[model samples]
Target: MKDVARVIVTYDCPRNCPNCCNEHIGDVPAVKFEDLLKYKELVITGGEPMEIAPRVVEMIHRLQANGYNGKLWLYTSCLKTTKWADRAVLQAVNGITYTLHHKPSQKDLSDVCKLNKYLLENLDNRAHDRSDRLLIDSRCYTEEVLRIIGLYDTGTKHWSSIKPLEWKDDECPIPDNEELIYYDLERV
Candidate 1:
């Protein structure tokens, strides 16, 4: 697979999710148009890309205008409001890999489900052709982070990294019944 240039646009996100890597809320710098033009795959991510949906849409439009034909992906926590997820934003993005945190509350699950439904309903039918483009990255293992490299569903062509708050080598083991699958996104 050809290597694609990727960038994490901002650290600022809307949710105060427990497992968030960015601990504090702050301003997320707008990705320079030139920088967006240089990459084959541009991943617009942040505390919540939806917070800056207007700017994100502008960035995507600019990229397309610049002849960037490569896939576009969004790494989102999906905690933002649905109004921000208008068709224009969905049209600009190729796929979304929603990060599902471990032991999330029922409210959180409901929120995610709602967001997913909105994405599925509002986007064009051709968006389904890009269903391989959407994914749910459920953070499964706190131990055996390496094993995570294999937990993906090959059919979906999506995977997520799991990081435990407390990890000790050889302390936790994966269950025997568990099956491992590898996904190749480039193929999708």
Candidate 2:
């Protein structure tokens, strides 16, 4: 397997979600600044990255300061805290993989939809200095999520992997795919 420089910045999260693959807990020490220097591509993931947005932004800046010109990708659930809509936070990230959980609310959906729209709108805009950034759809297994994937895939490519969660005997459906991509902080 090709080695990718990936780090899980924190275990703490704001949401107690069910579909989460990485069941993170409380905060931990910040990622080592030096580890980021050696990696060509850095993936920053957590229970909720937005909760630690400032730290994430600072880490990115540190990497850039050290002359690391690689790509930066942030993984987030786009919860109330992970506000990708904020221009400042969006500016720091080169790309984002927004994961959507099953929460049906107009405001929540609208917020996510707005961020997606913004990413497309600003891709090539010279004014924002984000002409070279890439925005990818990284939604996982869900009917609604799949629909969004189909929509984005019509024109652009998105990343999707099968991740089967351990189910209890009383769980409604049985898993069909044996090879499920379980989340691991070390293997970003």
Candidate 3:
């Protein structure tokens, strides 16, 4: 088994964003929970995992119960939903990388602030730098993104970044990098 695995919460998604990475995680057989135990890290991502928030919460519990000691991180846009701030979801993961969606509206920025506040209040462990993160989608890192990010900038932590968003391309990796970084993981 590889040292890392990106677990997709579901094959289906409501956003159905163009060139979404979920569409290109070519069949490698279903990655069972047990199969993931050997990994040093697990990144729970999705077609919006919050869509099945309960199942994700349970999955986190199950992984912990089975003695999976990896760092459990999650990736989500959290734009259309604030459920990511729910207590169970907040407490379970080691960290969360909230992607600030492209062309965000004022409501989107406000919602993110609310969610970050809830994360700080509910989990003391995450109150510091790096426990939670904010990333501006590279495609949308315009003046608007800067303005919105600055709205909530506490400046205590350098948490906001603008990385290339993940997308599917015939020869590109999930991070939308033109280079094929590593060979696809194949089970032993």
Question: Largest lDDT belongs to which candidate?
Answer: 3
lDDT of 2 by residue, 1-188 (tens): 12344456666676665644443322333434665565566666666767666666666666778898877767676534235334555667665666555443555566555555555555423344332222222333455653453445333322222232332233332134211121233323
Task: Please name the candidate that would achieve the greatest TM-score relative to the true structure.
Answer: 3
- lDDT digits (tens) for residues 6-103 of candidate 3: 67666555655666665565663565556777778777776676666777777778778998887877777753335543457756777778877666
Against the true structure, what is each candidate's TM-score? Answer: 0.55, 0.58, 0.71
List the candidate 2 regions with Cα displacement exceeding 4 Å.
24-31, 79-86, 124-188
Off by over 4 Å in 1: 17-19, 22-31, 79-81, 84-87, 103-107, 119-127, 132-188
lDDT of each: 0.48, 0.50, 0.60
Clashing pairs in 1: 12-47, 13-47
Q: Could you tell me which residue pairs clash in candidate 2?
A: none
How badly does each model clash, as a count of residue pairs? 2, 0, 0
lDDT for predicted candidate 2 compared with the true structure: 0.50
Task: Give per-residue lDDT, candidate 3, residue 85.
Answer: 36
